[model samples]
Every structure is written in structure tokens, then in C-alpha cells.
Target: MTTSRLARRLLRPPGVYAPQLDTRLLLGALRQEHLVGGAELLDVGTGTGALALSAARRGARVTALDVSHRAVLTARLNARRSRLRVRVLHGDMASLADLTWDLVVSNPPYVPSPRARVPARGPARAWDAGPDGRAVLDTVCDGAADALRPGGVLLLVHSALCGTDATLRKLEGSGLRAAVHRRAVAPYGPVLRSRLPWLRENGLVTDEQPGEELVVIRAVRV
Candidate 1:
């Protein structure tokens, strides 16, 4: 896909999660894998639909889902604006029924928050994963096998603070072979910087650290 072409098509509405470095990181992970034409792909927590469109550009039949109404609309708008055929659904993984995919990709809410549970509403829900930052990430791992067909793949991106080994174990426990697929250290974003006090208080990060390492975890259903 052409850079300018994608740039022109992506549209992020106010209050919806915008495409960010993690989005690009997952895109990079997807680029490394070779998906044949018509491969069924699902992008969980689709946000602005960036990954969904990217997969569509690669000839995959892409289906994207999100919990936010605004995000669902934004993704659908972008898909229509680009004239790409994408099925954008308004719901979360648990609400999605009886659909299996050849490949599943996600950039879930993973930033740590002081709260013990993920937010049910507000923009904070986009990134304020609870306590140890694995709220939604854990769910994704738990459902990977059910979401994919036999031998299908899953690509997920999240911060190192969330514990890569934890995700690997969850996926493996669910009958998928998993590994770290890619990694990049990124400076603290607005969300992380805002929660520095809680993060530091909980020993999630050091007082002087400037960044967190983002990792892409890839899993294959056996």
C-alpha cells in the first residue's frame, strides 16, 4: 500500500482511539507474514480500522470489531472512503459469535491503571487496562483458539510492562504455539505520562525510565 494513499484514507473520530505507534507495530508484524488471497482476517478492538484496511489491501477478507460506537463508525467510514470491503462490527470479543478466522490481530487496551478493573466507559477505556495492564490482553489470549480456525494465526501488540511471558503462557495454555514476534522501545505517551505516579507507585516502572518496550506476540492455533 502506498503511504500517501493510506494516509489520505485513515480517519479517526474524536474520542475514538487513533492509529498510533502500536498500530504501526502490528502492521509491521502483519507485513512479515504472507497471507494468501481471501484469507479470513479479524482485527479485534479495531479502533480506527487501520489494521483492518491494511489487511484488506493485502487481499484478506477483513472483519473488524470494537466496543465503542464512535470507533465502529470511524472504521466503517474509513473503509467506505477507501472503497474497501470490510465488515466493521460494534462489539467486543465476547459478544462476537460463531465466527472463526484464518488470522487474528489485535492492539488491545494495555496501559496500566490504578483501578483493579478496566473502565467500562469513557475514552480511558481505549487504553486504561487495569492494575498490571493485562485486562483485555488476557481476554484476547484466552479466546485466541476459539477465534481462529485450526492452524490459524494471531498477532498482538502490547507494552512489555504487561509481561510478554504471561501472554505467551496464556496462549500456550489455550492450545496455541506462541512467541514474541517483534519489539520496539517507545517513549512514554500522554497516557503513560499521566499515569506515571500510579505506575511508579506500583513498581511497574522506574522513576527515571523514559520508555517502555512494545512487543508483538504471535500465536498459532494447533
Candidate 2:
């Protein structure tokens, strides 16, 4: 099934993030990589297992992890409906520390928010990263090296407002060579639209800005 069709068919209940531009961007980046059959792949923060399903479609041995139980169920349901084999797990990414993959992909919570702490509940958990928007992104970058096998690849997509330079620095510091693999401009969604005033107050956006720039950062462990 095509990515768009798969996305449309996903069972995204309330609070489980719907597949959007960021998800599509990450999927595109993932498609660019050579996914050999049986190659282990991990999708962290798998919302509805869109990326995981995409990888699984390519014959990658895919594991999808999500901190939200609802998301976990949704992903598993989507996988079943798609007739795709994806190991969907419900838990924090840290819970899978013992496992490593040939590819790790994430389109994590990354919208900058006024909340001092990452939301433990609610729909915000899907996008409201605290303050500078690196709450989950930082963790993803830090864990990339350990999550990936030698010479493995990491594909991460997030808002450019979170600072691509910061992501590159973190990935490189983690011993992965990283660069922006793809970029696209997309208008802010309801979450960002609602937070526009706060974003302006925080100087994350300006009055004249058009939209957020989504970037897919691809890093490889050398």
C-alpha cells in the first residue's frame, strides 16, 4: 500500500497522533535508504506505526514502540489491518535498551511549548515538548548511537524550530555522522496554531513567518 493510503487507513483515535507532514517526511527519508529484507528496524514513538508499517512493507524486521498505550493499540490495529507484520510495543523508548537495530526512525514530540514538563497525559503528549522543544528529540539523538548497530542509520524528523544545528550537534556528540536529508515547509497544525501567541512571546516565531520547516535528519553510525 502507498504511504498516503496507509496513512489514511490508520486507526488514529483521539490523543493518538495522526499521520501528518512530519510523518510523511520521515517515511520519505526512510524509503531513500536500502531496507534489506530481515534487516532490523526500530521506530521510536511510533504514533500509528506509519513509519514502522512502511519499513515492514519493505521487508524490514520492524519494531514499533510508543509511550502511549492508546498509540500502541492503534499501531497494532493498523498493522493488522494493513496485513503487515510489525512488533508493536507499549512503553518508553528506554525500555528497549537491550535491542539494537540496523535502522532507527523517529518523528517524535517536538513542538515547543510553555509547559515546563513534558505532558504525561492528553493529546499534547504527541507534540508538546517543553520549552525549547528538545525534550524527546534530545533523548532520541543521545540514544541513536546505542540504538543503532555499527554503521546503522538513524532517520529523525522534527520541526526546524527545535534547531537542526542542536540536533546535529547532539547526534555527532553521540558518535553519529548526521546531516539534514530532507526539508519541507508546512503550516502549523492546530497545536502550533493554538500556541502561536506563546511562540511569539518566546520568540520562537515571528509575526511574518509563514510556517514551520520540517526537517528529516539522517545520521549514520560510523
Candidate 3:
């Protein structure tokens, strides 16, 4: 079966983040790395075990982490169904600070929201990242350096609406060499369309902005 099929076949229930454009972008960047066998890897905010299963299929020792219990279960079930070994964990990235991996990847919540705090429950938890959209993004950047071993790599994918330069700066400030590895432009989804006014008022988007730009950021702990 193809690697993409692994994601397509996964079960995604309501409230769990489903594998989408950002997930596929990160997966492409991951494939570019050509990870060696048994390389320790972690997929932060792993929704549906797509990225985790992709890496595991390449023989990487993979651990998939999510804040949602339902997501965790879905990932576990997908792994079992695919006959892939993944250490699926139910928690945010901060919870696994003590552990370091050869590679870390995440397609985290990066949508700017009107709410000051990220949704603790419900489907919004999958994509809403507070007013600036950096609530989770910033946390991921702050913890990324610590989450990787020396010489390890980090592959992260998120929307350009949240600030690509901001993400690069955060990653660099954390002591990792970072840059945009790949990019793709896509039309606004339902979530973004629903809050167009809020996004515009916040200066995250201009009247001229046509669609969302997704980017894959690659960082290495040297």
C-alpha cells in the first residue's frame, strides 16, 4: 500500500483533527529527509497517526502524541490496523520534555482565532490557536530544541497566516537552524471563511489576500 493510503485509511472521528493539506505537506518534507532505519521520531499533535505511520513505515521508531484522547485512540487503532508499531501518547508536547528524538515533526494548530484561549474541548481544539494563533505554535517552538537530540531535525508545517517569519525566528531563537523547506497555496477552508472579518481586523490578512499559504519548516539542532 502507498504511504498516502495509510493516512486515507485512518479513522477520524468528530473533534479529532483529520489529516489534511498541512499533514500532507509535512509528510512530503519527511520523505525528503530519508530517515535511517530505527531513527527515533516524534509526531507532535499527531492527528490520525498519518505522519507517525508514514515514518514508522520507513522503519523509524515513532511516537505519536496528541492532546485529545479520541485522537490518541484513533492513532493507536490506525497503527494496529496497518501493522505499524507506534508509541501513541495522549498529551501535549510539553508533557514529553524529558524525552529527545532523532527527528520531530508536527502539523500543529495555527489558525488565528477570536478567543484568547485555545479551546480545551470540541473540534476547535484541533485548529484554533487563540487570537494570535501562536498559543500552540509558540509552545512548540519553545520546546522543539529540547525535544530533539543534538544533530536531530524538526519538520513542522503550518499556515502562513500565523506568520512564517515569526515561526522561523522562534525556531532560530531556540538555537536551531531553520528555514522554509516547502510551500503550497490553498483556498480558505470553512474555518477560515467563517472568521474572515476577525482575521482581517487582526491584520493577519488583507483584502487582497486570496488564499492560505501553507509552509513546511525544517530545523536542525546542530
Candidate 4:
């Protein structure tokens, strides 16, 4: 049971899984800022429990939830392998039930295209937000304030070309103060590439824009 095998087994889907770079970057930055500790942490869309495990390693009490059963199982097994305790569950993001936390982190679905291609077995529920890429983000923004304790924080990662501005607006509208905490540029995948021209024609992207990029937003529930 290599770590990669464990991760792959947990994240194995029929199509493509969103890369874990954004989650890693956000967690790394949180560590640098002393944001996460042994506090109660909730990781929404916890694919393979990457962020959950990372936080657990740093002594945070982590609860990771995903809509995918395979993803939940993979996260549990990964936690066992790492000798960390992360409670993984299968559930919808908007309806979290009675659970609450001091910190909530998510890499929700933010694909703007309506027909984006994703792996069938991967945690697509965590990637394909909606037609404009703000479906899941809006819900997260709406639910985060109730999910977190006062002054708690929520970190989200999404494509800059999608609905980053809209996401910020939703968070603010939800009474959370939001900020662009991090940004990273990367090439768009096949799906984004196929839709880039359409997005450009619609003024979503510039004519000479390279591809898609990612922006990580950190918001606090005040």
C-alpha cells in the first residue's frame, strides 16, 4: 500500500479528477499563517482526504465529507495509513445537518461550462458546480456562515476565469468578509480549452488569453 496507491484508489474515477494543487496550496498557506491548529476542522468535498489528512498531520481534529462513496472510503483508508484520525462522510454540501466546526475548507466545483467532462469515478460533485461555475460556490457561501463558529474561516479554490468575482460577491452577501488569498496561473484542460473560445466570444476570457487560471479565496464568517 504505497501512499500514491492509496490516494489513487481513493480518487480513482472513470474520468478526470481535479488536481489537488489548490487544496495543497491553500493548506500550506494556512499553515504559514497559523490558521489551522488542533481546532475542529471540516473539509467539504474531501476527495481522498488530502486536505483533511494534511490538517490532521498538523494536529487538527478533522472531519472530511464528500458526496462520493468511493471518495469517502478512500479518505478513511488514507487516514488509517497516515495514522491520523479523520472522520469521512458522504453528504450534500448545502445540507450539512447539525454539524459545526471552527474552520471549514472546501474546493468546490467551479467549472463554468455546462458540458464539462470529468471522471465518472472521481469526485465530480466537487468539481462541476453548475453552468456558470457558481452553483456549489453559492451554496457554500450561503451555508458557511451557519456551519462555522463566529469569526471562523472558510477557504475556497476555483478557476479565476469562472466566477471568482461572483464567488466573492456571494460570500460578502452571505455576511462573510472575503479576500483573494492566493492566485496561480495554469493551462486549461481539454474541457476548458474547448470552451475557451466560447468564453472569449462571451467576454469571459481575452482573445489572447493563454488558458484558465486558479484563484483561492479565503473568507471569514464574522
Candidate 3 local Cα displacement, residue 153, angstroms? 0.5
Provide TM-scores for the models: 0.94, 0.96, 0.96, 0.84
Please report, as a residue range, the 10-residue window in candidate 3 with the lowest summed lDDT. 1-10
Give the per-residue lDDT digits (tens) of candidate 3, residues 26-144: 88889888688789999999988899998999999999999989899999999999999999999988888899999999988999999998988999999999888888988889999
Question: Which regions of candidate 2 are displaced past 4 Å?
Answer: 1-4
- For residues 26-108, write the lDDT of model 4, one tens digit per residue: 66555654545568888888776777877887788988887777777877877897788988888755556587777888887
lDDT by residue (tens digit), candidate 1, 69-185: 889999999999888999999887777758899999999999988888788888898998889999999989988899999989999999999998999988999899999999988
- As a TM-score, model 2 comes out at 0.96
Candidate 3: which pairs clash? none
lDDT of 1 at 87: 97
Worst 10 residues of 2 by lDDT: 1-10
- How does model 2 fare in lDDT? 0.90
The lDDT of each candidate is 0.88, 0.90, 0.90, 0.73
lDDT of 4 at 4: 44
Q: Model 4, 36: alpha-carbon shift in Å?
A: 6.7
